[model samples]
Target: MIKVYKSDKAPEKLAEAGYTCDEVKQAILNDQKDKCYLCERKVTTDYQVEHIVSRTNNKEKVNEWENLFLACNYCNDRKKHYYDDIPLPNQLEFENVISQTINLKTQKADFRISKINPQLAKLKELLDKLFNGKGICRNLMENRFWNDFMSVYRNFLRRVAAYKIDPTEENKQLVIEELSIEQSALGFKYAFLNKDAELWSEFQDYCKWNK
Candidate 1:
């Protein structure tokens, strides 16, 4: 996950028609770059207006702008109301607080907490489950999740490899663009880049973390 900046002023239609209205969804899609906030997957039609603090848990904030986010069905259904305390992407710089890496040998995602707090702990728990499955059925779903992640990751890796081979300014810019905040699976790409000290130093300054 990455830090997403949302407009504090709620869309007018959100106050009129409700959270599911096109105005509210379009606002969220624009803020989140049409990607699932939790999974970081690029989504078009398959997206939902998710609540940071679920509607069932906090009805008062049901239509609040700060409480709303964009998510894919896979993450929305699995997240439910269970992780209400997880840090909000709009509120925190998740890239600085949490780390997610794919274990090449196992072909699974692993999470590590870079900072500790009650809320951050909950964030870790939620991310762990979202990226790495717990049970049988969820494991099957997670396989597809991992595949989607790898699809973007591999493309990013290819660009990085090209930059490494040529060391040209243009190729370096390509790698930098791929890691921008608006790109899909930014957390994964950032984590992978962190593995290479030289490249990390070269591109770290160019990476956009927050809006």
Candidate 2:
């Protein structure tokens, strides 16, 4: 998952109508670029304004914008307050210490760590399960998740390939746009780059965290 930043000043409607209001949801969708914060998948109708720390564990932070995030239904249900201590994406950028790779043939995600820590480990486990399911529930949903991620990922790769073959200004611009931080399925996009040293060398600068 990529790091996300929320506006310092909460939306005015948040105080008037609370977090469930359309204004608040739109604000979150704007900040998150209409993608799930955990999975980095583009979300439209299935988006949920999720609480990073569950309400059951920390009720006080429920209405706070910093604690709010955008999530797809599957990721939200799957997470379900399991990791109360998992670091916030806004606070800790997962891409800094964690490296994600995928097996093209098998479509299985592999996450590598540059450093070891409890929070990072939990984040890894969370991502592992989200991308690669476990048990009946997750296995049932895994295909949908992978399909959604791969759709964007394949298109991104195609853009890269086109740029590589043509090396024209238009093709290069397309690749650059596809690799924008606001694009969906960025975790997989970045993983693809990290897997190919040559591509990574050419495109690494474009794969930047949102400031």
The model with the greatest lDDT is 1
> Model 2 Cα displacement at 95 (Å)?
2.2
Question: How does residue 85 of candidate 2 score in lDDT?
Answer: 73
lDDT value, residue 78 of candidate 2: 81
TM-score of each: 0.93, 0.90
Those runs of model 1 whose alpha carbons end farther than 4 Å from true positions after fitting are 136-138
Instruction: Predict model 1's lDDT versus the native.
Output: 0.83
The TM-score measured for candidate 1 stands at 0.93
Could you give candidate 1's per-residue lDDT for residues 61-173 as a string of tens digits? 99888889999988898889998988788887777667878787877777788766988888888887887776644466788887887888888989999999999999988
Candidate 2 structure quality by residue, lDDT tens digits, 4-41:
87778899999788899999999999988888888887
The residue pairs in collision within model 2 are none
Candidate 2, position 129, lDDT: 86
The Cα error of candidate 1 at residue 106, in Å, is: 1.2
Give the best candidate by TM-score. 1
- For model 2, the run of ten residues with the poorest summed lDDT: 132-141
Indicate the worst ten consecutive residues by lDDT in candidate 1. Answer: 131-140
Candidate 2 positional error at 29, Å = 1.0
Error of 2 at 62 (Å): 1.3
